[model samples]
Target: MKNRIQKLTAIKNAKKVDAFLITSLASLKYLSGYFFYFEHGLSPFQLLPAALVVGVEQQASLVLADNETQQLAFIDPSISVKTYESYVYQKPIDHTTQFLLQLGEAFKQAGIKSGRLGVELNALPASLAFFLTAQYPAIELVDISAEIAHLRIIKDEDEIASIRRAANLSDIGQAAVLRLAKTGMSELELFNLVRREIEESVGTRVPLMADFVSGTATATGGGLPTSKIINDGDLILTDFTPCLNGYWGDSCSTIVMGTPTMEQRSVFNLVKEALEIGIHSIQPGVQAREVDFAMRQHLQAKGNFGHHGGHGVGVIYHEEPRITPYNTMALQPGMVIALEPAVYSADYGIRLEHLVAVTNDGCEVLTKFNHCFQQGI
Candidate 1:
């Protein structure tokens, strides 16, 4: 875990702002040790605390609802916590006004009256934005959401370890899918089988997403499993995501239900070659788009391909430093990316994906799942 003070200092240096108001759950968890209930279980809507205020000087303050005060305190006992009962009306006595007033007082106490106040506009609610602006008219509000995202792009030791565990879980799920895949099995059935194995192996239910499809339905390339059934000589593609400790791992592989046709084998080999080219292209200082170009060029030469070649994976399955033609950011050490190269056709489709970590010299493949096209039940 990164020290809250170190994160705040990085934010201050990057954005040149006096302080940042973090409203994003992921960002809040990254800075503070608080892991909210919503992140662990299902809920109608995510309950977000008002805001976590971090100043350039390492000062920390949490503005939360009355119900969350104790929970936040347990997460960080030494931090200053302020509570408001904005929506908690069941209590005989409410501290809503007190919370907002204390928050304003904290700002005043910190001497942050007339400098740049960074806000996460993408994640900040409109109502909260209105209240902050109304309360602090002298402060200049700046959108620093991208600056925070930049901080999360590179993986630290702990973050990488979490992702590695996620990758191992995903590999287990893929192996289960490969073992159960057979002719006459519906895509949904195969998907559920993999889900069951993953939960059983982990000893608890976690967030696991699997997509299994074959034949013309495979034209979609990637999506949730449907009711379509597998048939002889059909190409089955399974893309899996397994989450561990708020981190994610993504990998995809194409399989043949029975015997693969010569045409299917040809397309699968082309995709495998393209994937190899893309993986070999990954290294520190290499442009992200160049990898996409190499994979796309290989597929286009073969006369079959898809739109996006690959993407970055982490806290969010799909995040920054996207592997597309539009991205120009250079790859750096500690960056983890998901590289997928696919070739789709009217009859069948083929795709192979792996999680890779960018190193000081080159890149290392993190996923060890089998990608054999000849493998069967």
Candidate 2:
């Protein structure tokens, strides 16, 4: 946490800002190591459960709701914390009002009264923007959304561990799909079994983001579970994404429930080959676009595919270091990315994704799952 604060301080110095107000929940977790449940209705537009205020010379201050004060006990002791009321019954004032009031106090405590303050304009709410200008007329609120996002692109050791665990959960989901899915079963039924298996493995009701589509639905890339029944030889593309320990894991696999046609096996092999080529191209200092080209060009004979070849993942599901035709950002060590290669036809589609970490020489594949479509089960 101290190292992250120092990096933020360096960004402040380079940008010549007096202080930085971080409102994004992802940014809050990245800096403070405190994970707040997203399902909680704290950040409903103008109200946020927490925000980190960093001054040029003083220690960073984390402002949060009084109801969430318990989180302070787990965070770094070097950082200070301020709290606003969360539950009150007597002539209650709005949460936004209390939040801004405490935020102003946090700035004052940091000795930042009048100077240019960095703010993530994209994530900052209109209510807070007005509060800053109204409270300090001379204060300059510079947009620093891009700068803050750049800070989280590289994963630390702790973050990689969290993501690795998350990937293990995803593998559990994929295995369930093969064991529980059968002909005549609705897509929703299969999905429920997979979800139950994953939650039971973790011993908790975990938040999940995924795509469970079957048969012709796979032709449209992927979609939510429906009443569509699985038929013999039907294609099931399961892209499971489960969040464990505040980090996300992503993996995609396409399989046939019964005997696959020659076309299905051919397309599946092509996608798997493309995924392998894309992973091999990943090395420190290699441009992301080049990796995209390597896979896209390999599948050129099979025609064009949809969506990006890959992207970075961590606190946010989809982020920078995007592997596309135009992205020029170079891959760096410690960066975790999900590479997905696919081919879609009028009748069906096939996609396979694997999570990996860019290494000094090449990359390490983190996703553990079977990627073959020739399974008879």
lDDT of 2: 0.84
Q: What is candidate 1's lDDT per residue for 37-71, written digit by digit as tens?
A: 45444322223555677665657777766655446
| Clashes within 3 Å, all models in order | 1, 0
Residues 1-377, model 2: lDDT tens digits: 33476677767777888888888868777887666776554554338768888875756888888877668755667778888876567866677778777888888888878898888888888888888898889889998878878988888887888888898888998888877778999999999999999999999888888898998889998989999999998999999888875689999999898888898888899999999999999999999999999999988877788789989889888898899999999999999999999999888999999999888899888888868675543
Alpha carbon deviation, residue 238, candidate 1 (Å): 1.2
lDDT of 1: 0.76
Off by over 4 Å in 1: 33-50, 63-114
Q: Best candidate per lDDT, number?
A: 2
* lDDT on C-alpha atoms for all candidate structures: 0.76, 0.84
RMSD of each: 3.4, 2.0
